[model samples]
Structure formats: structure tokens, C-alpha cells
Target: MTRKRINVGLIGLGTVGGGVARLLLEQQRRLSDYLGAELTLARAADRDPALAQGLDLPAGVLVADGAAVVADPQVDIVVELIGGLEPARAFVLAAIAGGKHVATANKALLAHHGREIFLAARQKGVGVAFEASVGGGIPLIRSLREGLAANDISHCLGILNGTCNFILSKMTAEGAAYADVLAQAQQEGYAEADPTFDVAGTDTAHKLAIIAALVTGRQPELNDISTEGITKIAPLDIQLAGEFGFKVKLLAVLRKVGQAVELRVHPTLVPLGHPMASVDGPFNALFVEGDWVGEVLLYGRGAGRRPTASAVVGDVLDLARDVLCGCPGRVPPLGSAAEPEGPLALAPLDQTVCKYYFRFAAQDKPGVLAAISAVLAEHRISIEAVIQKGREEAGPVPIVMLTHEANEAAVQRALARINALPFIAEDTMFIRVAG
Candidate 1:
């Protein structure tokens, strides 16, 4: 019996691209046997051809022009690892136009231009596999699309960015400051030099936008999310949280509130016993809640060359099996045209209501707590717990308070009034408490 050969064309010979080539070449026999087809790395294109030197490939297997690889007649699938909107979008559209399948790990590209790209693939009747886009090798997107298809997912909470998680976890465990841990993470290769995107929650929002579309049938813009970074978190806050039996984590949270969806990213305080709180270091964990499936948690290494490549290879095999069976677009694109409700509205952050952890730095004098309590009461923001650690008589003391469920608008108003007090020394720091 003979097996069909699915020729794969790759763009961007970066870390992930090299891993994909290595895996496809080394695991050819196993993958071919599993898919009932021979998978071939027919060609690859990278801007710097020198990057392909280490990957042992046949002569002329790598080219400088990505479009050439996409336009090749022998290529059946285009694996796009060049992570950006311009050329990657063009390359994916070109592949679909040439009637070829695509697999990509570029979450930013998909988050920004997915509607246009998926629509093109649909019109061309080709499959677009993006299993590597979110949660690295955790198979999160597949779980939402297939495994948990029967249930309507109501809420999704995840520690999406490994860099942010690593920083926060180290701060909690070792009682280190955010800056110190971030510096350590950079030295250890967990964080980049700039580290703005991961620390500022933009990277997590991109992944959240993708997951939100998969679950809610609507894609959200980056501006729609109320994003807060870990830069504002202080070591004193972490200590206060530990005292109250809570842990701090940068969380991406999405909840379906009636017809409107609430999307936000911030440093969240989860109960010490919760699974997300225990997911420390540079690991990712997504907690999805559904009507039928109940609660499901997918946890694993969210990023790295090998783990991300594993996801990309999984997508390759998926596309290969589809090509062999003569079924493209077998699974409808996420947020397809057939969704009856169309786009869902994002609930304004002002309307969001949740418990909160508030830290106020003020003079270690009388009437400070009373004045703060009076303002909170005026705004109807009741306090759940309060802890004030001892401080030297020369400096202001830190007062940490956990509040009951309250509207964000009220919290802001109350905080404003509290900040205006004469004894207050610095701006108040607050973190939302996850339910």
C-alpha cells in the first residue's frame, strides 16, 4: 500500500521554525505511520539564510523569499512561524489563495487579523490550524474547540504569560521585590530585556482575545480589555496577601455577564488553596468553566522553543491527516460567519464588580483608619479583613484591607476620597480578588 506525501513549506527559520524542521525530519516515520501519510519538509524560507546552516537540509531546500515557498507547487501546507501582521498575513493569504493549508503559532497575527485571514481560508476551502497560538503545548485551543464542544464555556481564567507568572511567583516565595525578580528572570532567560509586553499584560491580552473568540464567538480588541501590569505590585502587598491566605498572580479573566462579556487582565489575589495560586514559576494554567463539563484545568509549559514547536508539529500532523482524507475546513473557523449573534459587547470596566485587596500607606497616627473607613462606608464598599504591619515611628505604616463584593465605580470614588486625606502618604495600590 502506498501513502500520500504531504509536502510542508515553512517560513521564518527562528527558534520555533528550527524545532519544527527537526521534529518533522526526525519523527518522519512515526508521524507518517500515525497519519497514514508521509510528511515532508519540502522547503523553508527565512530572511537570513545563515540561520538554516545547522539544520541539515538538502541543497536548495531553504530560500530567502517566503512568498516563493508559499507559491511552490510541491507544497501542500504552509507552516508560518514568522510572527507579525504584514508578511505573515500576506503569506497566509497567498497560501490560501494558492489552495494550500496553513498552520501558524503567531498569536499576535491571529489576534489582530484573524477575522480577515479565517474568512479567506474559508472562502478558499482550506484548513487553518493554530494549536500553538495559546498555552504553548497545553492543547488549549483544541480542548475548547473539540473536547469541550458540548458545553457552553461561561468563564476562563488563566495565568497566560510565563514571564509574568515567574516574576510574581518568585516574589511570593522568596519575598523578593518585583524589580529584583524581574532582573533575575531576565538573567535566567525567562524575560526579555524590554519585557514591557509580558509584564504590562499586553501579551496575555492577545492570547485572551483569541481564547475569548473561541469561547464567546466574538473577538475583542486590545483596547477593550482593562489591562494592569505587575510593575505596581510591591513586596509588602505580597506579604499582606500571604497573611490573609491569598496569593498574587497576573490573571487573564473573561466572564460571560448576560449578553456582555467582561475581559480584563490584572494582578489577581487567589485563595492560597486554589489551583491557579499553586501554579508557580514559569508555567501556564488555564481554568475553564462550562455548563456540562464543569471545571477543567489545563496546565503545562506555556512557552519555549521545544514546547512551542511541539504544538506546531501537532498542527502539522492535524493538517496532514485532513489533507489525506480530502477534508479541508473540516472544523469551522473560530468565530465563523455562521454565529447568529454576531459580535458580543465587552462590559465596561466601570460596571465590573468583585472583591478587592487594597493597600494604603499612611502616617502611623490615630484617626487614619477611622477616616478611611468612613469614606469606604460612604461609598458602600465594606471591608472584609484588615491587616496593618508594625512600622518604625519615623515612617508611614502600610494598611492592607480586603473588601467585600463592590462595584468598581464605588471603589474608585472611595479610593479617591481616601487618597485626599491629609495623613495619606502615597497613592493606594489595589488588586482584584478572583472568585
Candidate 2:
């Protein structure tokens, strides 16, 4: 009943990495019982050598460079927690070359260079587990890559970024301006110092790129995913959305239409009754639709030290079980090798139909409503409802319109025409309505 210990080497000793190490030590007995093998941290590599000073590390373990740790014959598995492109990519490839299984949480690395890395891992006959990459601890990756492998995935919509979600949730709940809420998020450590990646939709796009790859069986071209950030979302818009029975949230949506797959991330208005609408604060939710399963939603902590570490260690345990069973590479990196046939088509915004919410200021005068309605008619964009308010501050009156499913191009053209009219004040505020 005795089994050999699986040696694990860790790269990066920051928040997540530290959490992983602590969890591995704290849960070693249970993990070993489940895995039928002892898992040990044989070595670790961190940028700051002094990071190991206060920690209780095993004796004779090397605190060497990442390359050395990966190259070490003693380390059976390598955990890469150091995020970013260059060194992380190089180190991971080196680990694969050295015949070590990899467990990572780097979404950006996997999104940008996943094909190459997975191909290399396949050739090397090693497992590369990235359960922590997509929805942090949600296990959505496994659900998509394995649990639903039998179904044909038609769509994947997610509230993927926690920082952006936190900011938007605060803005909506507290009626605070974007800047004020973002500052609070930063102060609370929910956001970063330079929150551009989180707030500007880049982070969600990265996660979506990975999820798209898993669902479509093809690497999504990052540039092809049209991205719109949450920066332009105003408190007024949030208030209006609420009055109209909706909530604002940043959503990463991917859908298949015929041969095309439309991938986008933006601030969207979800009906109050929708599943994603209730996923407020620093939480993530994914809604996946398949031909057979219809619709399934996954919700959990999207990020954090322990939550992310839980995912990473879960992958490590899965890999250890495979190693124990002598079933290396039993599952393909993407759950399958067949490339998706045909060109990856994206539905043009104009052609892609959806309900829309439009709000803008207009001059308080007769025929103003008629002029706006005429422009909408000219573009074939139908208005489902209209709310007009008298001037509150002796200027332009506020006009709000909700449109039925319409082409985005027509909406833009109509809005442009309305903006040019002598009565319309400025560009109209438009938000996509989701159910």
C-alpha cells in the first residue's frame, strides 16, 4: 500500500504561489489519500531569493532559478505562478522539454500562446493543467473541456473579470461615479494600481479567448474579439437600466451564428431576472449553451489567493492521479485535437440582432420626438418604448428609448442622424439589453 511521493516544484512566491504552497502542505494528507501517492514540494523558485527566508521549507530543497528548478530531474511537476509573457512562457516550455507536467494560472500566457505550448506538451507527452486560468476556482474549464465534451457548444457567455464586476456592482448599488468606485476598488485591493487591464476589458478578453478556444476547438484570434470596456458606463445609465428592470455588468459573450462566432466583452444591461445579473461584486459567472444541454450556468469566486490556489492544486492532484495510474496524456490538452472546420466567422454588429436601451438629451420643443422617430424609421430600427421627460434644468429634456431586436449598424446610423439634428444635444447613450 506504499506509494512514491510526487515531487512538485513551484515558481513564483507571491500571493497565489504562497497560497498554493500553504494549501499543499495543509492538505497533503487528504491529497495523498485521494491521489494514492504523497505529493511534496521538492523545490521552489522565486524572483526574490529572500522570499524563502521566513518560510519553513523542506531541508536540502533548492531555492535556485526557475530554469534550474524546472530542469532539475527531481521535480516531477512544475507549478508556474509567475504571470506574464516572456519568462513565464520560456520557463514553461523549458519545463515541458525537461519532461515535467505543468500546472499554471496564467490566463494571458495560455490565451496568447496556448497553441504552441499545448502542442509542445503533447509532443513531450506531459499534462499541462490550467484549471485556474479561466474562471479562477469555478472549474468551468473542466466542465467545458471534459464534462460537456459530448455536446456541441453553441455559445459561452461569462462575467469573467472580478475587478470590473466589483466596480460596476459598486457603481450600480451605491450610485457612485466610475472614478469614485474604481478608487474604492483599488483601495480595497480588488483592483490593481494601473487597473487598465481589468477596467478596460482586456482581462476579460483574455479569459474569453481561452474559453473560446476550449468551446470551439480552435485558438481564437485575440484581435478578432471586439472589446468594449466599462469606462463609458455612467451612473445615470445604471439608474436608467434599473428603472427599466435591468442591471449593468461587464460581460464576455461568445456565440455561434451559422459558421461565425461572435466574441465580445462590454458593459451590458442584463434583465433583473437573468442569472448573471445577480452575480454582483467580485464574483464570476459563466453561461454555456449546447445543442443538447440547452443552457448551464457556473458561478463562484473568480479570483483571490486561496480560491485560485485551490484550483491550481486541484489540477496538480488530477495530474498526480494520472501519473500514479500510468495514464499520461490520457486527455488531450484541449480535450480533443481536431481543429474546427471552416473559417471562424464573426457576426457583424449590424447583422447581429439584440434589444437595445438608448438614452440621450434633446431640446424641449415640438417635433423633436417626431424627428428622432423619423430617423429610426428611416434606418429600419424599431422603437419598442419611448420615455420623454420635460427639461429639469431649463436645457435639453431627457429622452429614453428602448428598441426591439435591431441591427447595430442601423442603430448607429440612426443615432448619428439624430445627433446632427438641430434639437438633439449630443451622442446618444446606447447599452445592449441582455436576458
Question: Considering every candidate listed, which one attains the maximal lDDT?
Answer: 1
Q: Over the stretch 1-435, how does candidate 2's per-residue lDDT look in tens digits?
A: 678889999998888888888888778898888788889988888878676665677786647688878888988999999999989999999999988899999999998898889889989999999999988889988999999998999877799999999999999889999999999999999999999999899999989988888887777777777888999988988988888889988999887878877888878889888888899899999998888988899999999998999999999988887888888777877888674453244666666678889887888888888888888989888888877767668788778888888887888888888888887777888888763
Q: Model 2 reaches what TM-score against the true structure?
A: 0.96
Give Cα distance to truth, residue 101, candidate 1, Å: 1.1
Structure candidate 2, residue pairs in collision: 260-345
What lDDT does candidate 1 reach at residue 23?
87
Clashing pairs in 1: none
- Give the residue spans of candidate 1 off by over 4 A: 335-337, 340-342
Q: Write the per-residue lDDT of candidate 1 for residues 30-111, one digit (tens) a residue.
A: 9888888888899999989788887898787989999999989999999999998888999999999999999999999988
TM-score, each model? Answer: 0.98, 0.96
RMSD over all Cα atoms, model 1: 1.3
For model 2, what is the alpha-carbon lDDT of residue 408? 78
Question: After superposing candidate 2, which stretches have Cα over 4 Å from the reference?
Answer: 62-64, 339-345
